[model samples]
Target: MLQNKSMIVKLLALLTIPVSHATGQVPIDPNPFWQSGEAGVYSTGMIWRDCNNDGYIDVFFSNGNDMALASNTIYISQYGSLLGTASWYSANAEYSGHCGVGDIDDDGFPDFAVANYLGTGGFSTAGLSNLYFNSNGLPNTTPDWYTGDSIYSFSCALGDVDGDGDLDLAFTTGEGYTTKKQRDLIYFNVNGALQTVPGWQSTMFTEGMDVTWGDVDNDGDLDLAFCYDDVAAAV
Candidate 1:
């Protein structure tokens, strides 16, 4: 958590330019991509975290697959400047699908988790997805996928569902076509590994797309917020 870390990031420098009267109030230039109809970057999920514990928020983007030349990237500053980036397929089959981030281990530092969907939307296959935990915030090594289904959607939310002090993860898969249609699941941390809570799959949270973790009830323990429907309806 690095509670004492500085929140203000020190900028290097800013240069000033003399203004010439091109016009009274210079007309704003329309966004080139918007005006020219150029295709923009497509991202599925992202998270804000101080990866270095330096107080600067780093951006982690996910593309959900290994296709698309530049599907996954990490940026530090604005205007598409690259800080560090990596390819997802550079990891084990245990982790090669959807990706996300959160304080999964409750060590105060944020960890990275990737859901290895294996480029498929089915759930019958085994060893399909996993989560890699970065106890430290470095991105040099491949991520670990130690939880959830690999063939279907590998989404996660962080919270303490059973009143434990440590944060736990809620996972889901099945993709809505399973015989039970019960992809919703909760993994309560036992010592370290994520162990599924009994009856978690029986929860009523079906047909959800995005799951956000927060203290909705303000009970000190984190709560859950689910955004249902598909991409268009979500937007």
Candidate 2:
């Protein structure tokens, strides 16, 4: 059966050559702020959490430099369906950098926090970067400027560092200057206003790219784990 052996060899060879076929799975393009693959558009950040407890990753997408169309567009989706989509702050403006999430107001529900770069399409224009407190699950109202605001919000984390049962927020901002020049702004909730928490600050990080919070140290106090891109070599 020489002919049969040749046919089997041919089939084996065909199988060896990597065949590429589409998975027929359409990826959910949930980021409404930036069109797919458009230049000068930033899409996602380091902050990703299971907001709906669905066991699926809820990805939040935003813009970096292109503020005109990027502002006010944050989409949250899982299972290929968009569960939440809202534009909160800096309407029709460009939002840059990263965002955070946790129950800052201590309602046992997670709240949302974002760090706006406060610049133009490039780093030329500078304005006040903002932090919005989402009291309810998602925004039911329009995203006007809130009462407590911060400028140059590069990154943020949510935790009750003081062990007060009420979760607080820790955010960082500033230029890529000295280590001390970079600052940590701790917002403690008191009577609905985010008052400052004192003495907990140190030279935690420089040029903080993203901030995450959890009980990493196992000390029962919620700790901060920040990704610092600029000083990775130093660490």
Candidate 3:
């Protein structure tokens, strides 16, 4: 049926999934360096975890204040490498875009989520779709939780979905190009909290964007996948 190029690079390396949540790679330095950290490049999305756990690997920059007024940044590690940025989270004008991490409230640290792409050509960039709670270790700048979107949210994801081990958040909205109708949210996390409308919503999807969870069908719970960047508008 399909050709074979090393089985399609081993099924694309088992579907290469690593968007960062515990972070890694800042260690192996033998002259391998890569810089580019002035932070706030009008970012639209960013998430890398390890926020303050310190073992290294950190970075969080999610901004989009209408082109230039950038905010939201936290680049830790100092003696381990990231060296600079730390402090400044969603400073204002609104537009966050797509952001995510985990832990959610399991408390052992790790937490981050933000997707607020509130309309553009249709007007309405109010933006507000967040959930940041790492508290004492630094990650809480108010938003113990916030969710409300229908105009457009790019994508934000956290896991567990329904296994009951905690951590569940998945939001995606797109269709701001106009025609309307587009939804995709799934909060769900009960006992550990994170419910305030959205146990599931899907208007058949439009410009959705990112969003990913596992458990394909071995069927134990978690299962979700959304990808759409539609810019055309007409369904």
Candidate 4:
């Protein structure tokens, strides 16, 4: 009876053991540094930079949903550890989508932009975007500027398209169940501020999803490429 009991106990222990450990294979840790615990609910956009000028790379992520009963938050990292949340400049808008970082004000420090895909009510069509300037590599709660009215922004990109030595802004806009065909836009940097380039808005294709600047044709000047979400045949 004692021998039979020992055999049953050993079988139970072996069943509890994981297959990887039993097979002598080491399991890899996905979140080895505990960075994922800091991610807030509905976290979408993430970017890495020296946000505090500490020479160590930091991370930033936009938590958009209201799942935690809290407002939209931007979580920052401090040398591989989750530091804290940054004060969002726009209190009323929900930033649960794409984000980009660049120096929009010709400052030495980099600035960041967040896109408000869904508005406060969670299905609002009046989406918005905000540009927060950096003060000595730290984000300023007060935004340097914001988008105009009736603009439903989705994604943003920063580049010197005109090659004038200052960073410019390009963004995509559209929403669900809307008849208005979405298009991309470019705001040229002029004297540390963004100005909508004349006739630029009319050149975008339908259903603009994202925009980026590059010299695709090997030209000296940078060209803009807009990606669309739908396929349209040339009729």
TM-score of each: 0.58, 0.58, 0.32, 0.71
Whole-model lDDT, candidate 3? 0.62
Clash totals in order: 9, 3, 1, 0
Q: In model 1, which regions exceed 4 Å deviation?
A: 1-42, 65-73, 76-99, 106-108, 116-127, 148-151, 176-180, 196-199, 215-221, 227-235
Best by lDDT: 3
C-alpha positional error of residue 43 in candidate 2 after TM-score superposition, expressed in Å:
1.5
> What is candidate 4's lDDT per residue for 31-73, written digit by digit as tens?
3333244333455556767666677755555555322212334
C-alpha positional error of residue 217 in candidate 4 after TM-score superposition, expressed in Å: 1.0
Model 1: per-residue lDDT, tens digit, 54-84? 5677665544332222234444433333233
lDDT for each of the candidates?
A: 0.46, 0.48, 0.62, 0.57
- List clashing residue pairs in candidate 3: 209-228
Which runs in model 4 stand beyond 4 Å of their true positions?
1-29, 36-40, 65-77, 84-95, 177-180, 196-199, 232-235
Q: Ranking by lDDT, best first?
A: 3, 4, 2, 1
**The candidate that achieves the highest TM-score relative to the unseen native structure:** 4
Range of the 10 consecutive residues with the lowest summed lDDT in candidate 4: 4-13
Enumerate residue pairs that collide in model 2: 67-93, 67-94, 72-87
